[model samples]
Target: MLASRNRDTNSLLKSEKKSLLRFLALYTSLVILLITLLSIFYYQSQEKLMFSNQRAELSKYAYIQTKRLKVLHYFFPERTTYPRDPRFKSAIYDIEYKKIFSLLENENIHFNEEIYRAGNYIHFVKLLDTYYLGTKYLIIEVPEDMAWKKEAWKQIAIGSVLAFILFMVFGLILARLFLKPMRDSIVLLDRFIKDTTHELNTPLSAILTNIEMMDTDVMAEKNKKKLNRINIAAKTVSQLYKDLTYLTLKQEQKDHKEEIELQGLIRDRIEYFTALANTKQLYFELDTENVIIHADKQKITRVIDNLLSNAIKYNKRGGTISIKLRIGSLEVSDTGVGIDEEKIPFIFDRYMRFNQSEGGFGVGLSIVKKILDEYHIKIEVYSTINKGTKMVLTW
Candidate 1:
C-alpha cells in the first residue's frame, strides 16, 4: 500500500545521539579547562597589581623608621627604646639574615627578595647604608589585603558560567550541522526503497497468482522443475516486498487486535516458507502447543515470518531447524552459520546485516524487535559462532 508517510526530521538517529554526546563532553571539558587557566592568570595579575600599589607606601614607612633608629642609636644607653608604628609591624635583620629585634607577629623573613607574602602578612625588605642598632635590613610587615581576591573570584565565577553556557549552545548547533548530511542521505535512501518496492508490488502479486493457477502436473518434468525454481524466486521476492511494505506503511497502519492461536499461525508460516527450505534440503522440527495470545495478528505474523525467513536463509544445506512454542515462551533455532558472539547485541538494529554472503536488506529483525517491544515481550539470544543461534521469546 502507498501511503503518505510523515517523519520528524528533528529527532536524531541512535548513532547520531552518541556522537553528539561525546562531542559535547569533550567540548565542555576543553571550555572549562581554558576558563580555569585564564582565571588563574587573571587572579595572579590582580595580586601583582595590589602588591605594586603598596610597594611605594611601604618603602616610605621603612625610611621613617630608619631615621628614628639613627636618633635612637645616637641616644643609646640614654633613650634606648626601639621605634614602633601602628600602621605596620617592623623587624630588623643583620647582614647574616638573622633577626636582631622584631615587632612583627611572624618573625620569619626572606632577605634575598625585596617583597614577598607569608601567612596573613606581606613583608618588605629595605637595605640600609648604615647599620642602625646593628641592623643591615629594615623589614616591614603588613596584614595581607584580600579585598581584590573577592572581586577576582566573583568575576571569574560569573565569566566561567557565561562562557560554559555559550559554548554548550554552540556545541549543540555544530553537532546538528555535522549530522545533517547523514540524516539527509538516510532520508533519501528510505524514499528510494519505498518508491521501488511500491512499483514491484503489482507485478509481484500477479506472478505469484498466475504461478499458483498453473497446472504443473501436465508440464514436462524439466519444465516443472524450472517453474518450481521460478516459484521459489517469486516467493522470496514476495517476502521481501512484504517486509518493505510493512516498514513504509508502519506509520499509517492501525492495530487490529484479536486473539491469535500461535500453533495455527506457526504452521501456516512454516508451510509458506516450505519451498524455500526445500531448496536447501533443510528439515523442520516443530514442537508446538495451542498457545493463544491477544495482539495485532498482522504484526505477530511479521515477527514469525522474519524468524522463519532468517532460519531458512542462514541455515546450512540439510541442516535441522528446531522450533519450540509453549504457553510462556517460543524458541526458533537453526544449525546454520551462527552469528558472532560480539555482534549479537546489534542484530536488532535497523538495516543491520552480519553476513554479506546472504541476500537481505536486514530490516527483518528490527521489525521483529519493534513488534515484540510493543507487546512487552522479552527476547533472548543464545549464540555460538560455527555452531548455531537460538532466539528465545518470553512474555
Candidate 2:
C-alpha cells in the first residue's frame, strides 16, 4: 500500500513538472515576442525621427538655394549663375522632371518630396512653387549620418537583452507561484503517510508477537489448522508493515553491520516460509556455499524474506523453488507463474504487480530493490510468461 502511494505521488510530481514547464515555455515565448515587437517599433520610430530631422535640414538648404536661383533668374537672366552649398550636392529639374543641371554628373535621383536613402546619401526632392530658369524640382543628396544610426542599434540590442533577462526571471517566479499548491499537497501527503505508518508499527508488532507465542500442540486438529491460517495472515501483514516501516522510518534506526553467513541466513528465512509454502505443496532446493557478507543484518534479512515470500506466494502447487548462493552472488529461481516480457522492466517499480491474483501489496520487489541498492548490490531478473523467473543478485 505504501508502494502504491509512492507510485501515485511520483506520477503526480511528473505530471505537475510537465505542466509547469509547458506553461513557463508558453509564457516566456509570449513575453519575448512582445519585447521583440516593442523593440522593433522603438527602433523604427527612432529611425523615422532621425530621417525627419534630416529632411527638415535638407528642405531649409534647398529653400536657400532656390532663393538664390530666383534672384539670379529675375534680375540677371543672362548670367547663368547658381547657388552653391558646399554641405551637400544640389540638382535642378525642369517642369518635365528632367535634370537640367547638377553639382554631381550622371547621378540617378528620384524626384519626390519624401526623404529616401540611396547608396551612401539621404536624397530629398521638393517641388518649387516659383519657377527659376525653368526649374520646377529642387533635389538634394546629403551623406547619411551613420554615427547616430549605430548608437540607436546599440541601444535596441541592449534593451532587447535586458528585456529577455527580466522576462525569464519573471517567468521563473510565476512558475514557482503556480506550483506551490501542488508542492504543499505533496508535503501533506508525505506527512500523513509517515504518521500513519508510525501508528501502525506497534499494533502490527503486537499481533505478530502474540501469534508467534501461541501454542499449537495443545489445540485440536481443526483448531491447529485455523491457527495456521491465522499465523499465515498475520505474517503477511507483518511483512507489509515491515516494508512500510523501512520506507518511512528506517533512517531513524541505528545501523548495525556484521558478517552474516549466507547459507545459514537462507536456511532460516526458508524455514520461516516453509509452512506457507506447504499450503501450496511447494518444495525448495537449496544449493549454497558457506559465503559470508558484511552488511546490516536486519536489512539483509528483509531482502531475503521478500524474495522468499514472493517465490512462495506466486508459485504453483507442487512447484519447485531453487536457491543458489555462491561467493559473490545469490540467485532465487522458481517454477511459478512468470512475468510477461513487457512487465519485466518495471517489475521492481513501486506498486508494480505482475500477478494480481496473488495476495500481496506489490511492495516486495520494491523493498528488495531499495535494500539491494543501498548495499551497492546489482540485481538482474529474467522472466517469461507461464515459464519461470530467476532473480540474481551480485555484490
Candidate 3:
C-alpha cells in the first residue's frame, strides 16, 4: 500500500508541474500579443500625425510663395523677366497671371497641385515666354522626407524604453508581494500539523495499551463499555498521526516506489486497528490477494490506515468495516454517516471535516489524495447520507 501510494504521488506531481508550466506559457503569450498589437496601433497613429503636421507646414510655404508670384507677374507683364527679389519662388507672367509670354509663352502652369514625389518642388513647366498674353506658369513640388518618420520613431523608442524599465522594476516587486503571503501560510500549516501529530503519539499509545490491559470478562459490562470509549479515542488519534505524517513526508522526500507485498501491508494495518474494532464489535471483512505492487511503503501505509481508521471512527457500534485489496486497486467501506452529495466534492480538501465532533484535523482524506495522485492512482467516493462511504482507488 505504501509503495503504491508513493508511485501515485510522484506521477501526480509531474502532471501538476506540467499543467502549471502550460498555464504560465499561455498567460505570457497573451500579454505579449496585447503589447504587440497596441505598439503597432500607437506607431501607426504617430506616423499619421507627423505626416499631417508636415503637410500643414508645406501648405503655409505654398501660400506665401503664391502671394510673391502674383506681385512679380504684375510688374513683368508684357515680357518675360527675371525676378528683382529672388529670395522667394515666383512664376513670371505676360501682362496678367494668365495668357502667354512670360519666361515661357502661351503656356499656363499649375502650382500648389499634388505631385506626390520627393523633391521640394516639381518642374516649373515653361521657362520662356514672349511679351503679352499674360501667361501663368511654374509649379513647385515638395516631396515627403524620411525626417518626419524618423522623428516619430525616436519618440517611440524613448517611450518604449521608459515603459520597459518601469514594468521590470514593478513587476518583480509585485510578484514578491503577491506570493509571500501564500508561501507563509503553507509553511505555518505544515509545521502545526507536524507538531500536533507528535504531541498525540504518546497519549494515543497509552490509551491503546490500557485498553488491552483491561480484562473484559472479569470486569463489569459498564467498565468494558468505558474501555470501548477509550479505544475509539485512541484510534482517532492514530488516524490523525498517520495523516499528518503522510502529509509531512510528501514535503520531506521525493516519491519513489519499492516493491511491496500488498496483502501483508493490508493485513498489518488491519491488525493494528483490530483492538479498536473489537471495542465497537465491528466485523472486518478483508478480502485481499497476495498482490505485489511497486510503491512507497510509508504512503501506502497511510492510505490503508486512513481508510480503516475512518471506517472504524464513523461506523455505528457492531457495524462492519469492509476492506478489499486486489492487484492495482484497494477499497475501504463502512456503515457510517455517508457524505452528502454537496460535501463529497470537498471531502478530500485539507482541513475539511464533515463532522467536527469526530476528533481529527480533517486532513486524512487529503493525505490519501496526495499519495494516490503521486502514484497515478485515481480515487472515487460514493456515499448515501447517514448510511455509508466507500472510497475506491484505481491505479
The Cα local distance difference test for each model comes to 0.87, 0.82, 0.67
Residue 306 in candidate 1, Cα distance off native in Å: 2.1
Q: Which ten residues in a row have the lowest lDDT in candidate 1?
A: 1-10
Q: Over the stretch 223-274, how does candidate 1's per-residue lDDT look in tens digits?
A: 9999999999999998889888887776347888899999999999999999
Tens digit of per-residue lDDT, candidate 3, span 1-395? 57544544443443344445555556555555655676678888976675566556645554555555556657655634543323224344443445332322223355443323334432333323332224444433344457756876777668666766665555555554655564456546656766787787787778878788877889898887777777776776666776666665554577677998988888888888887788788998879888888888988888888888888888888898888888878888999888889989888877678687777777788778877887789999999987899999888
How accurate locally is residue 63 in candidate 3, as Cα lDDT from 0 to 100?
55
Model 1 pairs whose backbones collide? none
- Give the worst 10-residue stretch by lDDT in candidate 2: 6-15
Task: Give the poorly placed runs of model 2, Cα more than 4 Å off.
Answer: 1-189, 336-363
Q: How accurate is candidate 2 locally (lDDT)?
A: 0.82
**Residue-wise C-alpha lDDT for candidate 2, range 258-361, written one tens digit per residue:** 99998999999898888889889999999999999999998999899988888887788899999999999999999889999888977886557877787655
